[model samples]
Target: MRVKLIESRKVYDGEVSMRLERFSINGRTVDKEIVEHRPSVGIIAVEDDRIFLVSQYRRAADRALLEIPAGKIEEGETPVAAAKREMDEEIGYSGTLKPFLKWYLAPGYDTELMHLFVAKNLHRIPSRREMDDDEDIAVKKVRLDAAVKKCFSGEITDAKTIAAILAYRLKPI
Candidate 1:
């Protein structure tokens, strides 16, 4: 796809940013808005037969969600490093990370590329990284098979978590 930019303006700048733009594509022109987000990583931390999950309230969604440990890739950080960091901070454990999948969260109007990894051989740490001030995460554990079932039964609704669970089921690391 080819798009010629006519104008671009930043509309919001917080943890996530948004931009409004005008672009023309192949003789057609239109205005568009996009979310500018740093790349992020989600870790499917599986130890034994269980998968680690985190339950936290999402202010934007106004409800608690069950999800895998995840966070934005910081500046100058690789996806694998971000995955390890998120696992440590959120789950208080670290594991061997194997990249599983990568996809755009919303390509139509977003620049967020999500990297998913399956973490194995987990071991607890004496002290984990501190959580972000805005985050209040509760760790949860469920049978790996049951988690995959939840994905198909609507219990696991978070997109990244669902994708990671299914991907691990299909092609485990």
Candidate 2:
């Protein structure tokens, strides 16, 4: 299968941008609206039997959601640095980070790739980094086993958080 990019035009720009992409596959032209987004990192911070999570209102979802500490990798920042920084800002912890998984958040129409990490040997930051001005986040601690149950019970609704918990349960890093 051969795919060729015919054209891409930025249609919307803000916190994230939208691109209208026209592609040709095997002489068949197709158009897809892609959401241009920066790569991000999600951290599963574990200590003893507890896993740290954050609950915040997501504008898109129109409600509060329980999610792992996560954020975009800023310009010139590596994914590891983003993971550590997100932990500090969202969960107020620092730890040794290990790469876990990398996957696209919504490949069908989005370009956001999420790098997942397992953060162990945790220590609370004396003065946690301030979260983004528009964000109001509350940290939550859950037992490792219970977190998995929440994933299945629909209590934990974030895709990245569900993926991390299930993956960690299947095989702890």
Candidate 3:
């Protein structure tokens, strides 16, 4: 399916107000407006039975929360590349990252599409995030089961984290 622009509306000339997704289905043209958004990447960093995670202060959550490594994809970056870069930057690890799952983080208001991945065959190195800007992350290594429990306990409420964990379980080793 490809978007064939039929008509466009300028909501705000200052910034990208919205994009009308125009496409054809069964010889009929359809249009759906979507907010312009950036793609994101997530990782379930795993080693043996343990999964690497991070604990950080989520301003929206009002406290420090546990979650798998994730971040937004920068301009002109692919999801697969973003996954590898995030794994290396956030957790100080690098290895084969298999594409796990892809979904919309929240479709109601935001157009954030997340690409979840499993970073297997990890190599532990010194953390590169020694002194980062506006980020204070505490690295944690938890058993996969424990991570799942924390997710259920609401200690980890991020959708990407939950999706990554579930994908890890369903995927073939």
Candidate 4:
């Protein structure tokens, strides 16, 4: 299947922009509201048997969510660099990072590709970066086994976190 963009116009612009797009697929013209978002990184930071996570209030979710440390890749930044930076800012830790998986957050309308990473051999940063002004995050450390149970019991509702924990459990790096 081939999809060709017919036209795109900026509909909203902010931290994340939105574009009204027309596409041609197999001779049919369809319209979609595409969210123009930068690629992001999520880290499954592990030390011993615990996984570092963040709990923060998400405007879209309307509640505090427990999620793996994650953030958007800054302009001119590599995914690995973003992962490290996010870990430092959100969890005050750093480690050896290995690529685990990469996938679109929501392909139907969003252009945000998420780079998942497994971070091990963790060390606390003496001078970790400050969290973003708009962010109020609290760090949470959970046992790996219990975290996996949360993923199964729906306590961990964040998609990226669920995928990372389950994937790591299924195939540890």
- Give the RMSD in angstroms, all C-alphas superposed, for model 4: 1.2
Q: Which stretches of candidate 4 lie over 4 Å from their true place?
A: none
lDDT of 2 by residue, 1-173 (tens): 99999999999999899999999999999999999899999998999999998999999999999998899999899999999899999888899999999999999999999999999999999998878986899999999999998988999888888988888889899
Q: Which lDDT tens digits does candidate 1 get at residues 54-107?
A: 999998889888999999999999999999899989999988999888999889
Q: How high is each candidate's TM-score?
A: 0.93, 0.96, 0.76, 0.95
Candidate that would win on TM-score: 2
- Per-residue lDDT of 63 in model 3: 84
- Root-mean-square deviation of every model: 1.4, 1.0, 4.1, 1.2
Q: What are the runs in model 1 whose C-alpha is more than 4 Å off?
A: none
How accurate locally is residue 11 in candidate 1, as Cα lDDT from 0 to 100? 95
Better of 1 and 4 by TM-score: 4
lDDT value for candidate 2? 0.92
Residue-level lDDT tens digits of model 3 in 6-44: 676644432335765666766688777777667889888
- Model 4, range 125-164, lDDT digits (tens) per residue? 9997988887899999999899999988988899989888
The C-alpha stretches of model 2 lying farther than 4 A from their native spots are none
Candidate order by decreasing lDDT: 4, 2, 1, 3
Give per-candidate clash totals.
0, 0, 0, 0
Scanning candidate 1 in windows of ten residues, the lowest lDDT window is: 164-173
Model 3 error, position 133 (Å): 2.6
- Sorted on TM-score, best first, the list reads 2, 4, 1, 3
